[model samples]
Target: MNRRRFLQSSAALSLLTAADFAPWQAISAFARELDDFVRGPAVKDHPLRQVSKHVWMIFSPDGFPTPENQGMMCNITFVDTAEGLVVVDSGTSVQIGEMAIRQIRKAFNKPVIAIINTHYHGDHWLGNHAYVDAYGDSLPLYAHPGTIQAIQGVQGNMWRTLMEQWTNQATIGTRVVPPRLPLKNGDELKFGDVTLRMHHFGVVHTPYDLCVEVLEDGVTLIGDVAMDHRIANMDDGSYLGTFKAYDSLEKMGSRIWLPGHGEPGAGVLKWNRRLFEGIYQPCEQAIKDGLALEETKARVLKDPRVSSQARDTKGFETNIGKYVSLAYLEAEAAGF
Candidate 1:
């Protein structure tokens, strides 16, 4: 069977199975477990540690993964300057955001003057309300035009979903907050001697993906655009576009990459681009061969490149299936 038929059949089978199984109950149970794990410990508030004279990073622990999967962790960074502090991405929950803020306060007496949201994802921007509630009108939030629309368009559904997946109803009732400011591309934010430049990388991870480059500090917070090749999520439109944007990042080198998840690394742009290419080439070949979706997914999963990454082998098949489905749609639209 070809790719299209396989997907159609698989989708039909999935729907039938879903109708018979109580997946929501399983999901609810897993969500509870995740909430317990995420809320188990509060990371001690540490003062801002300076990376450069003008740049300081407030490191906070990762947030719980969305209920969709396990082992994924989210992170946010804060850059401090003479004028005030500029947070890179607000965390998933208000408590996480507040904890990050407290750490910033421990290092610098200045208030948080600006927030740059890398994208519209709930994990990155949902904590904006926390800063707004604390600072009132003193804080200015920035994000790409597309990102702003995503946050406003969802009407907080994404936030609610994340809260439900990561935390229980009680926690959700307590800590969830909304975004305050909407930003555009090419917006330059100044804080004393430090200047944070925001640039939209067209449509990559999302239509509104933005990268923040600190000129003086030589650090780029490249949001989810730079993944660790561990089960890359392509549910968002433009998976290939993400590859192109990452290519641009590779050309525009930075000293260190502050990613939204995983450990901080150097030369992330190049590394991510290579990973994207590795995934893209095989999928493209499978498309050319007219393989069915399941065949393509199985082929991709068995490839040495897929196994090289530290991800569950079984999970790779599922991730590849998703990528193949989205990539097929993209290729079709482009008249491939």
Candidate 2:
């Protein structure tokens, strides 16, 4: 049996032979210790790698959570500004955030001054707990108003539960700590040597998805608006809105587009654009032709961009059909 269960069994046996009140007091103290042990061990530190002049990242190659990965499914980016280190997206859990903090201390040895939650997704922002713990409640945590609201409401606990389920309780002790400051599009914050500009295109990835441009580094931290090789979950996103966001992002003239899920590169937005078009355009055409959902799925699968990316893209085979259906439904609604 596990340590907690064994302790419980021993406690029960001692209770059967209780001749004194001291044993009961000891069991109560032991119960408090058991409560402290609910969460699994802290995640091992992942090495931090520099991505730009000011940005360093703890890159998690995996895109989905598993017991083995312990919910480290998103990239934790640290921008080293003269003021201090600014965390782009904290990570997936308190353990993951603590692990990232360990790496940050080893590499940069700077305190985290601020944290920006790109969207309301737990994988991107649930690690806020660790930063707040290390720094204090006074540390600035920024996000779009909608993101802050969602996390403050049901989305906060909902994601905490989901991550726990997905990671087989590996993330058991994480608590929801939503962003406090709300940032809108075109807002700029100066952090000593670094200047960050926030961009929000309505309902692209989510209604309040915030993309932060590190102006000095010529890189934009594109939250889930696009990804490198994996298709984004579009349950709250739009094909048309994503395209519009891409148009606006390209005009900003940032050279490197870093994503929350994959490696940073110039082609991050382009790669997602091509893949999204491959998934959505054919469905749009199918809707115009009065084609059924299955037929649209076939057309999307046969598209050159989709077929070529199928082998390399994570969740493409399993998620493409659902994406095609969403695209077809969107196209039909747009036609109305």
Candidate 3:
């Protein structure tokens, strides 16, 4: 059989196996079986904008996934190296990656030789499917060890499920493709003429957010550790740790900081830092004053730093309270 036939057979077999498991699984499998000939909906192609000499980005204006956006929420970056193209954060799904591939081919002639997943966030890496399809499966997928482990564990499937729900099944049919290679802090990878230096400082966005610096370009792709206008999800993050990261990252002196969300610019880190401080500082003070979480939330809202950016920040009204609450709890724990 040809490669295409083999892949089709494997897919059909997987669906058949799932059909034997449970009532829900059987129903899902039956639905997939009915649509076995159809592929997942392809995401509309977003134009790639060049950030620096070697880096280009497919910017997603939406910060959160919705049925309309179809999980195109995170920024997908590409580094054009002499060796081949290096993908930073593949994207949210197979369809998204497929769209990115079209965009990349339109702008650059180089093939994608490697993929770097910034973290285990589904939005950041689930699009590994399209890359693996376009390039061979041997394409090296790199991530911090903790990120690799998390994606290979429950976080991988959990994110796939979450994206499907968030996009109203638009991201359905995306497989969990975890990064196979583990990178550590201070590791330097030379992709032909361009050099990539990895930076991981304890816990910021997640326990293993990896920032890739394009040394020659003087650009660092800081993952979800910092977002432009959107407040980062602090469910597995630390305000103190994030502050420390900002301090260290600033010292790195990269002229341009590219975030996983939002446009890349010189002011990216400072913008996120000021907004985070607005949310976290008040919570820290509230803990000192023995104030309640509700009071802390009010204080955070009243802070000029946060309030000024409220209208511009996506999901600020809906997410700030939760971010403030997490910061409050972290502050309370730190006081002990």
Q: What is the model-wide C-alpha lDDT for candidate 1?
A: 0.63
Question: Considering only N, C-alpha and C atoms within 3 Å, which residue pairs clash in candidate 3?
Answer: none
> Clashing residue pairs, candidate 2?
none
**Model 2, 162-218: lDDT tens per residue?**
998898878866878899998999999899999999999998988889999999989
lDDT of 1 by residue, 245-265 (tens): 766776666787777765456
lDDT of each: 0.63, 0.89, 0.89
Error of 1 at 336 (Å): 2.5
Instruction: Provide backbone clash counts, one per model.
Output: 3, 0, 0
Give model 2 RMSD, 1 decimal: 3.9
- lDDT of candidate 3 over 48-129, digit per residue (tens): 9999999999999999999999999999999999999999999999999999999989888789999999999899999998
What are the runs in model 3 whose C-alpha is more than 4 Å off?
1-38
Q: Which is the winner by lDDT between candidate 1 and candidate 3?
A: 3
